[model samples]
Target chain A: MSRLSKKERQKLLKQVIKDNPFLTDKELADKFEVSIQTIRLDRLELGIPEVRERTKTVAQNAYARLRSVNEGEVIGELTKLKLDNYAESYLTTTREMALQKTPIIRGHHIFAQANSLAVAVIDAEKVVTGSAEIKFTRPVMVGDVIKARAEVKEIKGKKYFVEIKIYKDSDLVFYGDFTMFKLENGGV
Target chain B: MSRLSKKERQKLLKQVIKDNPFLTDKELADKFEVSIQTIRLDRLELGIPEVRERTKTVAQNAYARLRSVNEGEVIGELTKLKLDNYAESYLTTTREMALQKTPIIRGHHIFAQANSLAVAVIDAEKVVTGSAEIKFTRPVMVGDVIKARAEVKEIKGKKYFVEIKIYKDSDLVFYGDFTMFKLENGGV
Candidate 1:
């Protein structure tokens, strides 16, 4: 593809980073066909930190507002949560989560991310999974960053119905419907 | 409880070890109110290996028979697997899998063991989770050993229905019903 003009590239840079915050400066420069200095200037002008800083900021904000689960209990970094309404989280497949013989990511890691998000979206003192219907559309590999979004579809009595969708750069990798039970008495 | 006779204790020892192979010899001795040497002698008579050896034996056997997933893809050490039929696995909750503040085991780790076993029991080249219904009966803690069993309930075309139950020391901790999809063409 042809190189983008400076003004157009700067406009696209913000969108690209927003979509995938893990991209390194070198990668951004290559994608935009711009010099590293120019890419750095664009990022500075946009008030966007480096990839690592951006990741840390997102993690801290999400973890600070966590309610349903402890800070470290979540399988992924929660980015948004609306308590019995909707939630969003992000996870990067790591070497430990991949098959030793094949570089493919294990299915459980993907499932865990969605399941935890489902539980986190519930507005209750205690929540547990009652049931789930899930699908994996594609096999994810190590180093892939997954963005998972969960929405509360219904609430009846002590049960919360949640729908979760996971993506790797707009490709649907996994989806699930989870029924979570809330503990009103807060015993277990 | 009152102490049992030697013969009764020995019989109970074997049963306990069979149900929870992760129990150490010292733990067994404590439970039986016997010396550690007596426990060792009983294990020898019963033809049972030590805890570590038993765990390795179970893992090796399960990994050898694995077909759908790679050796490391399964969440826990599989003890049994019959393709399109039934499977069993074991997992020990660790510090990393617990809530940082409360030390309660995270729900996803329990779900992962069941979900992965559900996928591993499928007789397919590429299997993916379609949906699941699950329930967590009680909160698990670090150091708890969970044994999960998965049974294939039905298979139609490329869809598999599986039922999973998880136990911690003979107490049901979690249960799930899973629907998995198999890719017939095996592209991704």
Candidate 2:
């Protein structure tokens, strides 16, 4: 093996931590054949967070709960109706949209698919978005046959947590948890 | 005065409340000479939330307090030297990176700005993101001297809430509150 310079060693250490986040510091130190302090310095230099801290924070905001939909038969038809709600909608591969082979569609069309379903989840006549946090895990394109589903997760003081999931066939594609507020009748 | 149809009235009502979120239903009803219920229906049909609910949610998230900084001069100098501790680095728009001018810099650059600034805020030996929820607010352009500032807002267990604010020419542009976890020293 070629002798690694300090800069090269540090870069390697950073890459190791980034690629394998679950690896413990002691394990990393042992693998690198370096002192623990050296590993620590490498981490500090590279800005890799501690395991416990990173895991806890990620768990706090992450609302990913995957479940099978045996109701695909019903969901499929609902998906078509849900899509028709948009001003103009279609299904195509990611390549189609990326290549601009068809009329360009706005990103909001996808957003509205998830949004309209979330809006429908509120049993109230008037629902407003109190807080919305979404994570786009993958790129969505036409011909994906994406199915959108929203479920009520939390309810407190006229506020509700509605989890919306978008799936391409059976694979999970996009997920978001929207916190909505039910507006009072005739009240602002 | 021209007589407006119900559809016209509803459209006007939506425009009014959307532009000025501070307006109340009663005030709108009074201005439009319509019943309170009419105004509420208009809001419900248009998917507009009440101001109170939005204000309350904003307060809970502590974003309302930061709103005061929107029009003021925010500091951009580094008080600590941890630049070498980051895995990535780059400049981003004060607003959303997606809104930046196309065929210019890559989105990775904007992601790096938030990531590096977040690394700097940890004040730890190493920091990495367990999860993050980023929302683009506005567009950014080149030659914009962006000052990205990140602060450890909340610390629960090992996860830290790193709030990042990007400023361009003294204007608050991009704001991201990322949840980062602290990793063990020397851990990969």
Candidate 3:
């Protein structure tokens, strides 16, 4: 690939970091075919924090928005929630959540992010999984950022039917149809 | 509940610890309506390690049995795995897996455990979840030990049907039926 102009590279760098905040400066340099100093200067010029700082800020913002579910319960950081309606979460696959043999993120972590978002979107005291139909369309690797969205499709009495879809950079990686059971007021 | 004889209490203590290695001596004392010292003595007499030691042993044993899948990908420690046949795993709910408002374990943790075990049981270079039907029969609290079992019920071409069940003690807590698709050899 031809070398990108400084302006074009800076713009692309911002987009890349937004898409995957876990990419280190070295990786960015390799990907952009630029020096590490160039990437750092570009990041500073764009007012983008370092990768670790970016991740922490994103996680804190997501944690602050948690409403129906506990901060700890959600597999990923929750980015949005509208009770009994819609929810969105963000998960960055880490080394700890990847396979040792390969750096690929495990399927279950994706499922957990989807399933938990489905539960978190419910307006109830307690929610449990009744059933789920899930599909993984692609493999996700470590350092990938997954954005999962859950929409409550229907509610029949105490049962909620939710549709969850996960994406990595505009590509669908996973989706699930989840049926959740909501407990009555204050019941276990 | 009535008070038990000394021998009965000791036996029960050992069994309880086996089921939930996270329970502290004080918690056991509270449950048994005895002093902490008494519980410690009982543990000593039964040759049972302390809670932390018990947890470490279980985790180590589970980690030792892992194959084909990354150790970090599985939510619980894998105790047994027979590729394309059967698998078993153990999880001890920690404070991080519990709800802030309530100490009950998050539903997704249970789902992750079952889902990962289902993926691990497949005999393939790569396995992806195609769909799943899951039910949470009961709430699991913090400090609880969850044991999950997955059995491959059927295999057809590239698709494998798996049944996963999770239990807290003898009580069934969750169950799922998963359909997984195996990728062709060396396919991404």
Candidate 4:
């Protein structure tokens, strides 16, 4: 038979597991008449996060797992980095976080917090922002405790890019990038 | 009169308004000891917005002001823009916002809310994410409402670059962004 289309393969795979949540990859392979590897590939494409290590990710904060940083970690001081995620940074209004009277704390402070954490976790001491895009999905206000989690997504030559997500608790309030440049000294 | 350095001009301008809450253009000119035309030019160069009859922006919703949505005013309709003067936003948990959550709301819902708002306020209808640099600054759990804001700094042809900030009830939560793209008719 001609090779099945990607869409067709996915449809067939979904149908096989429509009744059960615990279908094994091998079982899926047997029913779909495909190799286990193909089934696994399909699962990945479908965004079905593997069930094997749910705790490693789901149990602990996704941010903590990505980096060595522990869950519920708080940054006490924003140290200096010659270059931040992007050559830019949020400087003012940071002190206003976690205050009362202001119905909403402010968005800039959140952005700064994200940027600061990204810079702190860098492997290179001097890194700059090459380019980035971010989506602001919610309102952050004063007194809200913010925790930043970041991961190194890719390392290409001298350029390193990381993905960071900010959560007030379970809600992902912010998401963006931290672009860092590796210094010639090899210190991050 | 000799031209002033950037620093000197800034200091002089500050001295003029040392105690006043506001300064008129003519008043600014006299204080700076420069022509009205010079003061006007300085204001533009410094990115100072002119105060007028103080027409409220069409969209007054937290997102609209932060993103700077552009459209005819529609009373009672919240602004969709996502940036404000201070790159700020306010936040309260769903329990606090006292608003019902929709199905579209998810881990990425808050992020998408602010991102989409930012995109909607862009001068063009067509837009795409060029890249994103982010960090998850705080834990946004259920019941926490976040306020977010972003600013546009650089504009290159179809590209509208920006910086953003987020907060949760007077607390600084998230911030960042160095670039964005304004598509030509939705074509990449």
**Which has the greatest lDDT?**
1
Best by DockQ: 1
Candidate 1, residues A1-188, lDDT tens digits: the string is: 37877788878899998876777898888777878899899999889999899878777876776667877667787777777788888897899886454566777788889888887777766676776767777888899888999999988888888999999878999888888887664422
lDDT winner between candidates 2 and 4: 2
User: What are the lDDT figures for the candidates, one per model?
Assistant: 0.81, 0.49, 0.80, 0.47
Docking class of 2: incorrect
Alpha-carbon shift of residue A11 in model 1 (angstroms): 2.9
Complex DockQ per candidate: 0.45, 0.02, 0.41, 0.07
For candidate 2, write residues A1-188 as lDDT tens digits. Answer: 25577798888877765443445678777777777887778778777777566444432322121111111211122322221121111123343222132232223334445654554445554554444565555545555545576777767767767777776645666677766665553211
Please give each candidate's TM-score.
0.81, 0.29, 0.68, 0.31
- How many clashing residue pairs appear in each of the predictions shown? 10, 26, 0, 96
lDDT of 1 by residue, B1-188 (tens): 36998788878888888877778999888877888999999889888999999988877887787777888778888888778888899897899886554566777789788888987898776776776767778778899888999998988888889999999877899988888877664422
Query: How well is each residue in A1-188 modelled by candidate 4, as lDDT tens digits?
Result: 34688799898667644433334687667766779898889988887655444323433332332221222321322222222232111122243442232344334346545644554455543433443455555655544544456666777777778676866545777787655554344543
Best by TM-score: 1
What TM-scores does chain A show, candidate by candidate in order?
A: 0.89, 0.45, 0.72, 0.46
True contacts kept of each: 0.53, 0.03, 0.61, 0.12
lDDT of 3 by residue, A62-103 (tens): 666555576777877776666778887788789887767666
Residue B24 displacement (Å), model 3: 10
For model 4, residues B147-170, the per-residue Cα lDDT tens digits are 566677767787766665555545
Q: Is candidate 2 or 4 superior in DockQ?
A: 4
Stretches of model 3 off by over 4 angstroms after superposition: A1-65, A70-73, A184-188, B1-65, B70-73, B124-126, B182-188
